[model samples]
Target: MNITISLKRRCEHVTEGTDEAGSGSLLNRIYTELYITEGQSEEVNTQHEKHIRVVLTNGVAGVGKTFSVQKFTLDWAEGLENQDVSLLILFSFRELNLIKDEQYSLLMLLHVFHPTLQKVTAEQLAVCKLLFIFDGLDESRLSLDFYNREVLSDVTQKSSVNVLLTNLIKGNLLPSALVWITSRPAAANQIPPEYVDRLTEVQGFTDAQKEEYFRRRFSDEDLSSRIISHIKTSRTLHIMCQIPVFCWITATVLDHMLTTDQRGELPKTLTDLYSHFLLVQTKRKKQKYDEGHETSPQELMEADREVLLKLGRLAFEHLEKGNIMFYQEDLEQCGLDVTEASVYSGVCTEIFKRECVIFQKTVYCFVHLSIQEFLAAVYMFHCYTNKNTKVLEDFQEKDWRYSRYSSDSSLDNFLRRAMQKSLKSENGHLDLFVRFLHGLSLETNQRLLRGLLGQTDNSPEIIQRAINNLKEMNSDKISPERSINVFHCLTEINDHSVHQEIQEFLKSENKIREETL
Candidate 1:
């Protein structure tokens, strides 16, 4: 769980020559030098540091941001570091969302969450040096209206949770207290730059760290070496290993495949890997909960098909709206009951996670965003195979020509429309979803997911059509960032023509440059 973290100062704006090659750049250089690793020391080392009142940390989903926050809190509680502060209050946005509508004075709020503090008077709280850690701003449901909200400077004054949070962050309430906020990159801007004294990022793992992660995970040296070597062979897998969660997924999958007698080539493509992962989880669920009966992979999946599809529906609907966190109501909306949802976490802990933030109110989310995308794709494909035209029509609203009743609803046409829809997205959030959709089209993946997907048209012509559609996709209109995904889709389908052509083109260009030199 230990990963590398890089700390840097927040820059309002970047311009050429601002820190260009001079002693003036020393300030920026000092920030870059601050790297923290859990294995090294409990203390964070910094040079030429100033008093940091409010810090904002941003990292991608599943990049160990929450882990770092937990470690910091644990270290503080154990008196391993930062003993100067009298009190440290850790508030995750997920838990805070439960009481977002309630009004409480700063003192009352503290007393409610920490009952031990109920006896502490407001006068005593005002003088105590405190640090407030707000984690997962991306999952917040509260309206943090910092600009227009009325501010109360008194600790005894009652107000909405939003107001209290804004006022505290703005230094209007308890200005002497230190504040630390963590969020995904997209949601980091929620806290205005003026309120942040420093910015840090959880960079996940370095190359050396990735190797160490596998070595530590597996007790068998040979197994760990094989896992590391296999990961290195796949460029996509190696790059994804940089994210700690993805590394765990990779380890889980490879370990299951290598240790078991199941006969097949190691999964190279994302779709193939996930397909195996699903099967592995199902098998584990059976062994753990179902009297240890031996069941075929398909039967294992069939046993959990209904609940998995419900979860998939939840993943697909929320993924469209860019929501990763889900409430109990959200789960019910997708036809998933509390008992059914718990089965997922109880069995496949890494695939789905449920956290009891406070008051026994649980919050749920897929372990990683990519898994959500994968499940969403699975759900979408299931809809297609069942001819659930209502779902398809809702997804493909712009394409009036392709109706639910239309006879031309082939895999190629369906996937092409999905590609077009994903490209239209401004932030490319749907890029991975679309890639997973295309990946699911492969006959190999279809067979692997046959239990959940039901009967599919796995004819050679149908599969070829889907592959050809991806290869001939027009990329000129889209940004290069999104365009690269088309090639990834092609890779998923095991079509390497585009990749080989690119390699040849690069080689020829290099040869021409060599001749000119």
Candidate 2:
């Protein structure tokens, strides 16, 4: 999908006004235009002009920042755009993290990753125009000591990978080279604001673009139309379609439900949709790798339960630490081997993926942050069902007085404790995780993933208690943003009373205002 890019100038004193007009389709065109404009402005202007050297682009996960970087590099190599640059080097932080402990000169580092650059001397690099693109700063495990790292101007001087990167970004090495970095918003501050000349944000897709995506996604006009209509029916889904990955997920779930004989009511809640999506991917895996004989959804899940749970464990552990990327050791910690990880990745390629970086090392991560959150919730619920007190205690450390280990601890109380913990998060990283946790409390969703989740008390009494707890949650105790998530949790559990009450209250307030006017 084509993403919208908004540009902003980062000044020493304050951020300059955002230039929405500069937003463009291709990343290459956007950077090239800015570079060319700055070059032209330098000749005629006497005042000091900011040279567009380092551009930091921020976007949430699955918002297509990496895709834009790939497209930009491709366009440059194809000579369709940005021909002014003599060399373009792209590096992902995930790959860089593999060599974080190694020491190498900047030139040597280039040679190690891109052998074609081995013959290029420091003198040649000084004269040639170059662009260095670093993708996925959010995945970096490197300690970027930007402020305290010793300065190294010589590209041939050996230093730690972290030091080399810090110097390069600070313009102490290869000062003339243009540097571009892409990161999710959470990790964008790794590079100090003073080093960034321009800040760009990738706003995934506009409403018109969303419609265009669906139209192109399906060849059948009727199916595409129906999917689009269904998406529009839910405000939450429509807003989430702004992320291209979520659009793909929606299409995958809806398409399977519409085309198959399992024509049940269309999914309305996020949990409902994800449950169907999990089944769909499992079915696809069976069809591809197993015998041609059809099997029930429960049987398919049963076959893959071990691997999925291992993955879920991985997701849960990392979710607690606010980590999305995983290495071999991370997987090993969760009792997952490379082979098991491969099987799971093969099953749900979009949900989990393994990328072979430079050398033979591989990096693993969920396709989107939301997927990690969902799986983490599933794993946490599994722990609760199996009476895994250790995991529960670790999660609810601050609420140990709540008797989480007691047999009488209900799903409502467990979810309330999780919700409280999520509210304590300043970044709200656990918001979706808690939402998914509440969603899993519903018997409908539990039944959908019966095999994977195992047995749970999703009885009506428990479900109603959970919904009531959500309704009674004090909005004053949390930020306005988090309060909205409480409402979302209610929606996920198929409760509409809170929504109806809010609408009625708004109507009454509006009528009173009209009378006063």
- Please name the candidate that would achieve the greatest lDDT relative to the true structure: 2
Candidate 1 lDDT for residue 431: 80
Over 1-517, each residue of candidate 1 has an lDDT whose tens digit, in order, gives 1101111111212211112111132222212111233221122323213777888887777777766776666556656778898888777888888999988898888777665566778777689899998999988888888796597899899999999999998889998899999988667767877667777788878888888878876889999999999999997788778787788788878998787676768888888888887877776766532233343656767877887898899999998887888998998898888775454542345467676756888888886788899999999999988988788888875554555466568777888888878878776778888888877888777777788886666567877888777766644767887778888888787778888999999999999999999
Model 1: colliding residue pairs: none
TM-score of 2: 0.84
Candidate 2 per-residue C-alpha lDDT over 272-364 given as tens digits, one digit per residue, 9 for 90 to 100:
888887888777766531232343656777877888888899999998886888998998889888775455443556467766768988788
Per-residue lDDT, model 2, residue 307, is 80
